[model samples]
Target: MTVTRTLALLLALIAAAAFAPIGPARAQSEGPLRIEITEGVIEPMPFAIAPFIAADSSAEDYTGRITRVIANDLASTGLFREIGRDAHIGRVTSLDAPIQYADWRAINAQALIAGRASVSGGRITLGFRLFDVVSGQQMGQGLEFAGDVDDWRRMAHKIADEVYSRITGEEGYFDTRIVFVAETGPAENRTKRIAIMDQDGANLSYLTDGSALVFAPRFSPTGRRILFTSYDSGFPRIVLLDITTMRRQIIGEQEGTMTFAPRFSPDGDTVVYSLSVGGTTDLYSLDLTNGQRRQLTNAPSIATAPSFSPDGRRIVFESDRSGSSQLYIMPAGGGEAERISFGQGRYGTPVWSPRGDLIAFTKQHEGRFHIGVMRVDGSEERLLTASFLDEGPTWAPNGRVIMFTRQNAGGDPALYSVDISGRNLRRVPTETAASDPAWSPSLP
Candidate 1:
């Protein structure tokens, strides 16, 4: 099967049903311990991941690698704490071995994970189970995944997605990708190229070279194309890149005007972007099926960075119509925009959340730049990170986390991610500096 097909199977296995409560079976006589995500988390919930049982001697190396991946996925969320490998007291020797709940409880583990892996017929088959040691019961249905032996890392991620979804009562985003601008060189002369990588900073690849200056690379809904601004022709042009063909088409480039900062509509049939003409920048949409253009914003002030709501009914964008950069919402076609941001800052790069409930943005206030989010209607505003320069907020596939560029004074740009709850702030491991990351929807 193709990579996309395999991803479809993974999502089907993990997300076909709505989120159930994260605990033991509801019919249990005794109450089960659970983690409330909204509650103040003083510490991460403790869990243990045992070495996966190798169904064959040929799978022994893979068993340990896959087990560590599951442990890292849970630990990185800042919700589950993995007890050190040295703390292990029990192991699984068979695919159907009984979990030693007493051993897990003795080590203060609230939850335990066990699995078995096998290599056969040029394929790898994996089976995993989750247990609630506190309640001494299985957490959910056991799962099995089969795939090519070379795709062991992807299988590990698929398993991790299942474990995360069952324990967090939320959709899993592990099987996703991020496109960004990879940077190198000094602060004064930084060179950037369009780059792609897995959510965990693995499988890194540069899609473009440093010959052109690129910014704000947004993925299409199908994740097959990318829209970004490139300054290769002495003026910025919005370029559409087909990943499979490695071909580029500059969208709506006229002789006199410069077009930049392009983004796709929810359905991916059209693009909305900024076109600077005669000292005025306005928002415009280009029909990809036909070379048709419609101006969405004809304001005197600069209007740019337009993002569509999930349903395509509305668009949120940044403009300086009110004498300061702020966020506004309007109809997808064209209409009066209602101001959504009225905070003590200059806001830019407003991105509507994939969940459609919140809008993430970059705010500059009190001599500091912060990544912040607010309700779609611009209420309940909360800032997630602060740095000398924090901008271009992009939501994770599940809308639970935001990734953006963070640069300090006289420093180069790099990529960082923060949870929507204002926790788990960490830098994405990149060999070079990175910025303007756009997360792809869950694959397949």
Candidate 2:
């Protein structure tokens, strides 16, 4: 997405998500969203992950390194804690050696993971298993991966997914990838374009020519195509581009209306956006399957920045019908939108967390912008960053970290990340100035 429109939509979204309420009932307290889930209280899992044993002399090169990467990925999630390397008791270089459950229990680790890496010719194969220390039994069947040596990280992520799914009974996020805007250049004339990369910031590839401004690029659920808004015609319109071939097609045939803030439904068969007609903006949804269009909101006030919930049964967007912008959730097919945010600021760019538990947004209050999260019902507002301008938050596939753009007045803009808890803030360095970050779904 173009930097200006991206920031503008975020500005509108922040106004929609954090504005002051107009009525005495407190719009947010109308009632919790119907899709609310009572996620159980989470406790860190103590896991002992050791280097994969090499099955033969040929496999020695990547034995320890590959296993270490797997362990590190799991530990970094914050849900799993790794037992220190120095605390390891009995080493199992081969999966066949029975695990010493007592030793892992001594370290207070509930789960023990052991694996072996083998290379036959040019292909690499990995096998791993998770053990329940308390039960003294294998938690699930062993997992195996086969790929080229260059795909070792993918294999590791798959192994982590298996373990995560087995323990939590929830779908694993490790298999996902993120598609974001890779930016470089000055603040005013930034060389921004669409880019795809792994969730860990690796294997980055440019998807646009950098000749025009692209903003808010979102991946289809299948990751085969990307839906974004571009200003190739000097006015923004919703466009869909095939990520692989870079071919694109604009959705609407309107002559003068400008479209912005586009997103794909969970099914990836529909797109929702705001179209400005004669200076009045409203919400509309287009069926990608048939090119049919339907209006969702017709208020003179703007109803922009639409996002679909995970189940695709509802949508959360920002509207200014109350004189100022605030978050609103409504049925995906179209209905009354219940206001969700009642804070003393403007809320904008409301993006639902992939986990379906929280909504991340941009907030502006008292001359400063902030990136924050709140329940779908607009409860428990937690701001993650505050600065001259912090906007455009995209969640990591895992939902534990958020990436966005931060601009300091006339200074260069850059991409930064912070844990959802507002900790572990760090900047993601690019070859040049980067903004308008759009994280992709997990890689195929």
Candidate 3:
């Protein structure tokens, strides 16, 4: 059979098996399998993944690797727990085999994922189905993905994204990327380079050599370009780098002035950044199409770290206009601003969430640093982390998690992420000391 027809037949068969009647050991709960992320302690839902059946010898090498990545992706979220394979009473030997729902429910598995893999002519195809074991029904229709063999990991991430979205009702961040500044050597003479990596710290590649000091690498909305502050010419300047061509151009440049902390507008056609001239710093927006600059904030105090709202209607940034560093919101076209942070600490590095409902920022007070978030109007302020130093909070694509740089006393900085609910704080793996993490939007 042709590959397309074969895939369709496989999905039809799985759909048939997924709808079969539940046996005697079915769960008592009639509610759909779901997790509500809240402030209270949550018991992780248990899920199982059967070994992906390999359709051919060429596919054997990838089945285990793909399955492991999928499991890790779900487990890292702190919402799903994996039921070890040793506890599985039934094996998934074929894509068309009927699911033994009784065996899965007997082990308290609320969700079951079964997959099949096939390889032919330098391409690999993956098909999977997610079943809500407790409800004894398929959570969604069976789906399949095909890609080059070298992109197996991305395929696995795509599958995980589907499963995550189906159960959590939120977009998945598994297939996104992160851009950061990679540091090496002593604290005083460290070399910083622009680096990019997969969300799980894989496929690491340096975009720039350690010759110039790079900071605050921000991804464009399309994830095809980057904006960062570079000190290559002995002064900080905003530089735009194209990921596909590796071409760099200095933007927002002015004679005898410095510009930094740049971010792209929602439409990716304009850049908002801080410009410093004559010891006075202000925020400015530049249109990429016609090279027109519009001053957003004209304050005597420092105003920097400008971020645009998702709708491109307003901008949120940090300033000391109130006698200390604090976050403020103003119209995107430049007008009167309003202070949004009234907390005890000094706030800076404000980032507007992709959802446009909240803002994430870094705060410092009484010898401790924190990463926090608050509603757009500065209500319901919540601090998600407190440490010796935590700064530069970046939201995940779904706006459910925030990643920032954490540093202990007399130690190098590392990337750390925490759920918005103030749980599941964990370090992000990287090869060297890293900071200034910028999360890219979900890939197409």
Q: Candidate 2 lDDT, tens digit per residue, 1-444?
A: 122322343244233222121112212112211111123444567888877888878778887777776776666556678887789886775677778878888888887888878887666777877777877776655655666777777767767766765665443456556566666766568777877665555567788878888877887877788887888888998778997787889886488789988888988999988899977898899998898999999888899888899899889998889988889999998898899999999999899998899999999999999999999889999998999999888887657678899988987777888778786677765655667676666555
Give TM-scores for every candidate, taking all chains together and pairing residue i with residue i: 0.92, 0.80, 0.93
What ranking emerges by lDDT with the best candidate at the front? 3, 1, 2
Predicted candidate 1 versus true structure: per-residue lDDT over 1-444, tens digit per residue: 122343466656444422122222332112364555672554788988888989899899799889887888778888889997799887766646667789889999988888888888777878777788988877666667776777677778877877677677666777778999999887677789999988888889888899988889999998889999999998999899998688988888988899998999989998999999999999999999998999999988899999999999899999999999999999999789999999998999999999899999999999999999999989999998999999999988788889999998988788898889999988888889889999998766
Task: Give Cα-based local distance difference scores for all models.
Answer: 0.84, 0.76, 0.88
Tens-place lDDT digits, model 3, residues 208-229? 9999988999999989999999
Checking candidate 1 for backbone clashes, the offending pairs are none
After superposing candidate 3 on the true structure, give the runs of residues whose Cα lies further than 4 Å from its correct spot: 1-31
Candidate 1 error regions (>4 Å)? 1-8, 11-33
lDDT of 2 at 65: 74
Q: What count of clashes does model 1 give?
A: 0
How many residue pairs in model 3 have overlapping backbones? Answer: 0
